[model samples]
Every structure is written in C-alpha cells, then in structure tokens.
Target: MGLLRLGAAGVVLGLASMPTFGQRASAVQLPTYSYFTVGTSVSVPDRGGAWLDGVDRAGSGVQSFGSARLLGGTRAFGTGRSAAGVGITATIHDFEALEAGLVDRRVRSTNAAPAGNDAWTARLDEARVSRAGRGVPSVAAINAELGLAEQAADQEAAGWLQRGRQAEEAGKPNVAKIYYGMAARRATGSQRREILARIAGLQPSPEAGQDAKTSETRR
Candidate 1:
C-alpha cells in the first residue's frame, strides 16, 4: 500500500499497491476522533484470485472498539463464464475489542466481572504469548492496528445495509433506522435511495412523509 494522507475532513486517502502472493505490507494510519485506527489492503493474484482488506480500532480503554473487513475486490483469469469470477466481502464489528486489553500491554483491566475473571486472565495470558511471538506491544503499534481495522470496516456499506434489513425484519425499527442511516451515508444511487426510504418508513408521522417527498423531489 502507498502512504496514506489525512484530508481536511480527517479521512485517510491512499492507493493500494498491487500485491503478490505471500507478500505483506505495513499498516497505514487512518482518521479517528476519540481513538486510533489503522488499516492495510492487499490484493493477491494467484490460482484464481484472492484479496484481504482489514481495519482495527481501539475502544475507549483496553477493549476492541470495532473491526471490519471494509472491501475486497477479485478478478478471475480464465475464459468464458467459467473462466473468470469476481467477489467482494465486507464486515463490521460494533462494541468490539472486549478482549483488546488482554492483548495489549499498555492496557490494564480493572472493572471485569468476577465470574469470568479467571477465564479472562487465561485469555490475557494467551494474548501475551501471541504478542511475544510478534513483538512487544506498544501504544503506537496498537493504535495503528485499530486505525487499519476502522478503515476496513468503514468501507463496508453493504454490510451496514444488510444489518439494517436484518434489524427491520426483526421488528426493531429504531435499530434498523440507525443501520440504514449508516448505510445511506456510504451508499449511492438506487441503493442509497432504498436505504433512505426504509428509514422514512420507520418514522410514523405526516411530517416525515412530507419530508420524504421533499427529499425525493430534491434528488
């Protein structure tokens, strides 16, 4: 991946370098307000094709705030319909990093539940061992990982839209509205319109209906 620059709006903008098999790139800084995030994107061209894109973010303290697979693009290298294929994957994690403190040396657990304390400690030990295999963890390093995770998650518009649909089907309109709003923020064209319409449907008021009509007119 190329060097990432921060825009005036604090968005991380960068181009990913073409990737080869068994290749790894360093993490790039991502924009965040309250915490830190970092990300890496790779495209590996192999038998058919494979790609991995991920971002990580730190929580308020020692937990994972969230982690997501933001984007994946692949192309097949064969002939006819069977010759080529393309696929994409996107994911998001909210309230992530519950075990982040266990992995990072800088974070010390304080308010954990008593019942799971022992299990948590064991997990922390495992994390410590894993970290040792890589290297000592530092605040800067952890923040970079989180930034990457956040960046990856931020790119997952479809994931958010799906979540909205799931919440709506579950009869949780309020929750669905939140997810739809997130999806609409990143969606475009018909997809965005569909998400916005779902959101409007959740609001039960004549004014909301009028507002929707006005929005449609403007669009």
Candidate 2:
C-alpha cells in the first residue's frame, strides 16, 4: 500500500510517549480528526498499474492528459478488499519497453511530473482517511472521486493581473503592487516582464517612508 496506516486522526503521535512492546500501557493514542501530509515518490516500475483500491486494470484508462494511455488516462475500477489481489501482475510490457503503436513509455516511466497535483492531493486525502480510522482508498479510488479540471497557472496569473489593474484604477498603488507581485510569480515571458515594469512605475507611499524614518529616529 502506498499509504502507511495511521491513527484514528491520521496522525502519528510520538512513540516515545508509549511503553515498549513488552512494557505496560501508560499513554493512550488520541484522535485529532484531521489528516494532512506532504511528500513525493517515483515508482520505477509501478508494475501493477493501480486499481481503484489497488485492484487490476480498471476497464480502460481514458487519456487524462496526453493523446494515449501512456501520456495519461482516467478509468473506472473496482474497489474494496475483494479486488485487492488483482493487478499485482508485473511483466516486460509493464516496464522498459514501448507498446506497439503507442509512442509513450511504459507504466512507471511515463510519470511526466514527479509530484503532480492529482497525486499530491490524493495523498493528502488518503492521509486524512487513514487518520480518521476509515480505511485508506486505493490510488485508483482517489482518482475516481477527483475531477480533471484545474486552473492553469497562466489563468491564475491573469486573475491577479486583473486585480492589480482594478487596484491601480482605484488609486490604490500599494494594493495594486501586491496584486501585481502575485501576478508576476505565475506570469511567464512577456507577461512577467510587464508586471515587473508596472511594479517599477509605482512609488513607495510617503507614509511608508515616514514610518521608516520614525523607527530609525526611535532607535
């Protein structure tokens, strides 16, 4: 299983607080009811292409990203312990070779982005579930519950750009600077350069300068 079993709240409390295996129990495990985690992994073979709850081929993986399955796909699969034993098979086609007409690499090698958004969010949800004492869902199951939609980085930058423009029009240079700065972080190429130029055009507020001077005088 990709996720390790967690406590009722999906948290791993300090083991030092508990007695050793042979010792008597003194401390008790507490549940916080919240689960969260952050990490990444790259499974070289990813042999048994994941099922909903680690089963087998979930019917067919509909290409979620690229043109073909290797590029990425989404599919429905069975869940629960019944299907647990499925998809455990591993072979040559699973790794180290290209399939017939398919141009992409095999199962694991096709991991285009190491810690993609989907995987990361799934891990987070799994962590919560495990901590909540609810059984952890398989990677496939997590995908089944999630949607493919997401705001692209450029789209987010555009929103920030619009906010900055609004602030500028309202005569709030300080506020506009904050929004423009955020826009620059997600903007690319010319858009980023333009944001920086806007930043340069705005002058620091007179009140800000006086505040700095007052602090210096106090020192």
CA lDDT, candidate 1, residue 206:
44
After the best TM-score superposition of candidate 2, give how far the Cα of residue 197 lies from its true spot, in angstroms: 0.8
Q: Would you give me the overall lDDT of model 1? A: 0.50
Every candidate's lDDT: 0.50, 0.52
Q: Write the per-residue lDDT of candidate 1 for residues 1-219, one digit (tens) a residue.
A: 133333522343222312322234333444433322223332211112222223233333222211223233332222211122223344444343435545563433433323455887767766764545786789998899988876665567689989978977876665677777777766766777887887888843343334323311110
For model 1, state the Cα shift of residue 77 in Å.
95
- lDDT measured at residue 175 in model 2 versus the true structure, 0 to 100: 68
How well does model 2 score by local distance difference test?
0.52
Residues 129-207 of candidate 2 have per-residue lDDT tens digits of 4446676789987775543322466787899899989988876677688788778877777888999999999865564
Model 2 — TM-score against the truth?
0.28
